[model samples]
Target: MIPLRAGTVTEVAVLGAHCDDIAIGMGATLLTLARARPGLRVRALVLSGAGTERAEEERRALDAFCPGAELDLTILDLPDGRAPAHWDRIKNALAAFRAGARPDLVFAPQRGDAHQDHRVLAELVPTEFRDHLVLGFEILKWEADTPAPTVFHPLTPELAAEKAQLLLKHYPSQAHRDWFDEQAFTGLTRMRGVQCHAAHAEAFVLDKAVIDFGGS
Candidate 1:
């Protein structure tokens, strides 16, 4: 894997349309990053599920995923599956998040996501984080919406297992969903690993990246 030579990301911004989107998409990647860099700054924003059980679930889930980091998370009350209708509020939230800190990396839903809420947030993230490295994470669901990921974060077998267990443990609200299970999570990561010649992996779709081939 070609590494990002951005000189060690101290802060990262994670944007999600719903509670478990980030965890479902990139939980292993977050664990890997946090373990590599203690005290990494993680600022997360979820558009929906504020003042609900889902929001609480997300707060605890992120804590598990981002171990040893200073996590700054905000759960907004935007209605689920209605991001297009509340464009202004979402934009304002993104603007406020951008103004607070210039994160070295950003994670958000990919533009091709079939869900409208995911698609809208994916479209909006680039507008706010113009110059930062933005990795668009894919969430597998009932619809066929997986993109050809250009980037891959290879997860070790242990990390892959940890991610699945953490998801199952923290997000009890999602346990009722048919897709929320260990097999589905591990199977997808294993498939992604095959693409990158690893035991497991979390992939991402990114539009642009500046490579520094000068050294090493």
Candidate 2:
């Protein structure tokens, strides 16, 4: 893999279909970025779970994931698993978010995700953030729809472990789920790390990018 550096990313945007999707998909990466750039601007949007405990869980979870960063989160009350049906609202919300933040990098659900809510949001992201670098993050679930990721963010064992702990700690509502455990999170990170020749890592699908080979 040819290594490409995302130079001086001061702002980032993350989109999720549900409350814990961002943390599940790229918690370690957020941790890495926030530490590297203190007071980094992070804008997050979740389509479901507004006015509920799940939304509260997401607020705490993202704050923990993005330590020391300037984080702004929005949660909506759109029905879960039915994002495609609420296409207009989703599109409008995305447009409003795009107007508010000009992020250097955007973390969003991958297009190939099996979940309908996730897949719909992924499809809508590019329409709003047309000129930005968007990284499609994979969420481990019961479905066999993980994308073949083209980019990898290698993580230290300590960072990976910390991500898992944060996920477990902040989202008590998800603890009952069998897959929402440290072992599963660490296992996926370990496998991705093996693929990328690291001790631990997070993988992402790059839908598109404009590389500057000769720039500073």
lDDT to native, each model: 0.92, 0.94
Q: Please name the candidate that would achieve the greatest lDDT relative to the true structure.
A: 2
Q: TM-score for each prediction?
A: 0.96, 0.97
Candidate number achieving the greatest TM-score relative to the actual structure: 2
lDDT of 1 by residue, 1-216 (tens): 656545788999999999999999999989988988999999999999999999999999999999999999999999998999999999999999899877989999999999999999999999999998999999978888889999898888888999999999999988888988999999999999999999999999999877777897
> Candidate 1 versus the native: TM-score?
0.96
Q: Tell me the spans in candidate 2 whose CA falls farther than 4 Å from its real position.
A: none
Per-residue lDDT value at 98 in model 1: 92
lDDT of 2 by residue, 1-216 (tens): 667888899999999999999999999999999989999999999999999999989998999899999999999999988998999999999999999998999999999999999999999999999999999999998898978999999999999999999999999998889888999999999999999999999999998888776879
Ten consecutive residues with minimal summed lDDT in candidate 2?
206-215
